[model samples]
Target: MVSSSSDPLATRHSTVSRENVREEDALKVLSAYLADDMRACNQAIIDRMQSSVPLIPQLGAHLVAAGGKRLRPLLTLASARLCGYQPSAEQQRHVGLAACVEFIHTATLLHDDVVDESTLRRGMASANALFGNKSSVLVGDFLFARSFQLMTADGSLKVMAILSEASATIAEGEVLQMSTQNDLSTPIERYLEVIHGKTAALFAAACRVGAVVAEQSEKEELALEAYGTNLGMAFQLVDDALDYAADQQVLGKTIGDDLREGKITLPVLAAYDAGTEEERVFWKRVIEDNEQTDADLPRALDIIARTDAIKTTLKRAERYAHKAAEALEVFPDSELKALLVKTVLYTVNRVN
Candidate 1:
């Protein structure tokens, strides 16, 4: 979602400092750094997504064409490059592994849209909204199955075990989120746990597999995994903040979709924890009881505005972003490594 603006990751208040690399232009930076690798990985995605069943490819292509940042797969490529994985003609295991990571991410997205009952994705009609929940769910399962095929083709027991465990953790995170819905008293620790599994687990695995494909030392593998984990945390934390504050057109979803669905995020928790007695009662009614009216959103916004919840959440995201940067210290100084650090900055700084 790069804009015409020079600093694409700029927010309403300020622009990201671009002293090292202008990683603000995500599409451009990714293209410049990992162009061929990404093209191969995308082809692998297209090749593997094909099915005798027309609807499978049709539905899969719809979302793929919608143009997400493709950050997860890109992480695979970046990590592989960081670990000095040169693709030989006979073996481009990193490409297939990257595609596998994307499939896992896309499957989760399809399942998530159905579970959220979301009407839109990336500003377009969601697969579930267009293709029906049954189709979305089945295609998601299909994608999950396809990912296993790719992993098996790679013939690495460790990679398979890592991704399989991540998949299970993702499902567990989704179930935990469902259970926590409409509960304002959900602990911040529980919220972090949910995100660690739902979002960060796959990121960690995606990064780890790149090092595995590179046959890198265990230290490099662990370092990349930590980087991806911290970056994922920052990314999702910013996403939750955007749900409360981003412009509708830029965010591509309703600003208060989480609240409308009775999902508790840090903003809601901040407001609830800091508000007056009457304000707490409102939160109990709107979030806990799932009783909401048209006016409730504005009231919730006001509370958030007063409590500075979005800022607090963004501050927490910055902490994770810093950790992500710190994790990359294991890698030597190089353009790719600098870009990786900039990616961390972009995660927390991005307006979209």
Candidate 2:
């Protein structure tokens, strides 16, 4: 045993790193990989999306140009490399596939903001905020249609199936989550199902599509898929936790955006389950009845602290982190594989 205490990647450092791998360093690694891969992804997105409607190209270009972490594309490129796909031989086929993943994700975000009536995204005014909801929704649909066209051009039935299924699952999960907004009784399992569908399914598909494009062995594809799914689940769990635990400046949104939106996340769910009768009534008034004072937020925060919801959720995320690392055992040990696993740990463990 290397002793988890000495191995930041091995230990569940949900709050801080035990080893010297600071958050900045981890972000630097991810940022470098994203920069290297994004130029190709952007070109592919642009080349495939030239359109008759001028606004279609303009909106798509703006969204693409608006920077994001580009996590999905990076996963695809890294998985392909780790699985022994040679760029010289494939000639950037994997990069094209990765761009497709990013387009689909961006399209969903555009529609999601419209549906959620969100004003800010990626630390700036959302498309729905600047251009009316109608434009955002229509442009989002255009992106989806364009993404499918690009996927079919890839000529891999397996890749098509994986991405198509993920698109459908994302729609279903969004509906499921919409149905539960403000319903206090929504169980943890249902919440998990929603996140798995809405988020993890796409992440898993991104990696699996890369494997398919590379014609990797079925076992290797399965490993990559598992890695993607687990990492995604961990990522979302941490995101939900951070909504309550982090400050507005750090989170890039109003603190308690979930609460304001009446979105009942895992921390809130755990706190409700662990609260007293009085606390339960408070949640009902604030979260359910939509009648709450400013005091409610601090009270809710107190309840979460009392229930240890943050810690509990962190532990669950850590389990998924370990599972994501384990999924990569089948791949030959290499720098790419090590970085992939490290990124998973860093994503779930980061405070912001």
Candidate 3:
């Protein structure tokens, strides 16, 4: 349930348990378990990212070296293992396919940085910031082409279809977000649709392809897809909330960037709905009118504090996290399963 406290900051001090494993620790454990496969995948990524064009390789290396957690590709590897995929010829296919997933993810990030006009990514200069928007966009297209090559090399039409659809869906989601940007009238349902397409579609495809490559049962594939989709939702929700709540240093990006971009995220919607008439004017002036001033972010935060927006947004995230865990219940207990469940908790606890 969302907190009822009128004190907007009350949730920050609420005594939620800190017993859940940290995100980094859980990732470390997963990485250790999949060390060999990850090594192969990393090598594959390096080999594939190379280009005769110096600028292409240089720009790709810059972003790839920026050191994201590789969580999406990790999900591909871990889900395959969770489905009892053993190391062998078929398992080598998983490594290559996992590399493909990473390529797709990296391509999206390149394009996203351009679209968001973001200066920083993964705590470093964004590709567009360093290489220029034209280079970033073209390199992103190259990555997409490389991803398709890997998919075709896998020789599974089903896998190709799933990933291709996800790619298209991600673009659609970006367009949807653009249409909704600065529009406070955007409903929560539409916002969710945008996230499912932009964020969760790739995640769902990543896990589902793992099952497909492993030749797991349909039920198991569906379960992994559910886990991935819900986990992605939770991940994006926490990210949205963190734009308002997180420390700029820890967040790796400027706080209030969403507001500056006139993006109406869930917390903003909640606060707008719950705000008084006078407060609504402030929101309209800043968000709808795009007239945010230097002092507006703090006052916007103050308005959010008076509402249950942050807590409610987090509550929704927790619900999705719980569903993600539940989706894995069909799989037998193991260290992998346990770690995946812990990952859900860690995702939600990022702002805690």
Candidate 4:
């Protein structure tokens, strides 16, 4: 057994990795580590998103140009490399598979903005905002169809099953969230289930497929799956917290954006549960009743601060991040393994 004492992944995870951990640093390191494989994935994504319909590629290019981290596809590529997948350049299908993950993720983003009536994505005008909702929704469907084609080309029944299930689960999660929207009474458990379906299911599937291609043991596959799930949970929880607490300049998103959308995040739930009766009334007005005013944001922030809602939400995120790190214990420590562990820590601690 590799002793955890000497392993940097385990050691830093137990100590400094949890402090001053920047998301950008992890992105840079991971980008460097997977440089070659990532190029292939990028090229594949570019090639596959092309459509004879000018509007399809035009809109797809806009989204691809907007450029978030591409974290899901990176997870797929990294997981495969960690599992010793070293196919010859000609045999490299990890690129196609990773591209497929990105397509699904991109499709969901397009669909989500429409559902949320969002105007901005990554600090720029959203696809729907620029292209119109009808165009955005149709292009999103186009991306989904493209993703399925990528999956079929791979010709792996197991991979098809995993990605398809994740796609369906994402749709179901969005529906579940709609039912709970603007209801301060939404159970924390139900909220968790929603994130698991909408966000983490794809993360889990993305990681698992990498292992599947490498023909790793079931034990190893599950470990990576667990890692992805918990990382995703932590990622989403931190995102919720950030919407209330993060620096606007760094993340290119404004505080209180999610609250304005009637998102019932952990901080909102905590404040609702811990607040005085009068505070409850305020929450109902702004969030539940959807009667928010310009002054309401400052008031909401004050209430959340008083109740330690942001802090509490972040603490909850920490628990999930720790679990994600622990899930990697089955893999012997390598640079990739250590970076993966660090990525888990970054998920929870990120300011942006």
Question: What lDDT tens digits, residue by residue, belong to model 2 across residues 227-279?
Answer: 99998898899888987887666446556778877887899899999889999
In model 2, the Cα lDDT at residue 102 comes to: 85
Number of the top TM-score candidate: 1
Weakest 10 consecutive residues, lDDT, candidate 3? 1-10
> Worst lDDT window (10 residues) for model 2?
1-10
> What does candidate 4's lDDT look like per residue over 182-296, in tens digits?
9988999999998898899999999999999999999989998999999888889888888887667656776788889898889899999999999999999999889989999
Instruction: For candidate 3, write residues 90-206 as lDDT tens digits.
Output: 447788889999999999899999999988786798889888999989999999999999999989998999899999999999999999999999999999999998899999999
Which regions of candidate 4 are displaced past 4 Å? 1-23
Model 4 residue 221 lDDT? 91
lDDT of 2: 0.80
Off by over 4 Å in 2: 1-18, 31-36, 88-91
Better of 2 and 3 by TM-score: 3
What is the Å distance of residue 140 in model 4 from its true position? 0.5
Judging by lDDT against the true structure, name the best candidate: 1
- List candidate 3 stretches off by more than 4 Å: 1-20, 89-91
Query: Deviation in angstroms for 229 in model 4?
Result: 0.3
TM-score for each candidate, following the candidate numbering: 0.95, 0.91, 0.93, 0.93
For each candidate, how many residue pairs have backbone atoms clashing (under 3 Å)?
A: 0, 0, 0, 0
